[model samples]
Target: MTPAPALTLARRQALINRTDMAGPGRLRLVNAAGQSLVSIELDQPCGTVDATGVALTDTEFAQVTTTGEVAGALLEDAAGERLATFTAGLASTIPAPELPLPAAQLYAGAFVRLIGAHIVCD
Candidate 1:
């Protein structure tokens, strides 16, 4: 199957509802053209840059990668499948994850958060 055109990460400012303060909010990956790269649903964050990775539903899990300064994650589907990966523009050859993971998956947002907006509001 032909893969969807990959979009570069544009602003990691994920939306967090002020009302959902009680619970973890949803996050997404916006493209350079200002379009949502994928439809992400809420789930326990399944991403990390450390040595360990987060395990998703039944068997899905994310793989962590590093290049000294930058980090990335390879998203997996439930039943243990290699969907795609996100490398923080570190001159690596990691492809982006395919669209729409199950009902809910956590990879982009969880990893993106580590890079955040870079701007602090005092």
Candidate 2:
């Protein structure tokens, strides 16, 4: 089998930097049906990019608009253009993961917070 191509630290930083340039992005938590349950505006400048990738700034609690089990996450730029999609899971299940919610089940009218979200280019 062919080995997968690897990216240098500089290359990874460059890619993340480009995405961060779209600053003030949005993080959307969605259900299995692809319906948004909560939408939070990321910090201006979004995050810091380094050899490891981007470590997103913590987000304020955003009210849940819909109730369901979180199945995935979507990252969008300031203009609402999608930048990436991530698999959602509990924190105990993954490493340097995305969408690691405290609970899988969220209800409308409740608030959710996103903390320590990191994105890697690998």
Candidate topping lDDT: 2
lDDT (tens digit, per residue) of candidate 1 on 1-122: 53222211111111112212334323333333323433233343433122112222222222322112223333333322334444323222235222222222223423322322111110
Per-prediction TM-score: 0.24, 0.76
Model 2 segments more than 4 A misplaced: 1-23, 50-52, 94-98
Clashing pairs in 1: none
lDDT of 2 by residue, 23-90 (tens): 67788888888999999888766676655556777888899999898888888877788878887767
Name the TM-score of candidate 1.
Answer: 0.24
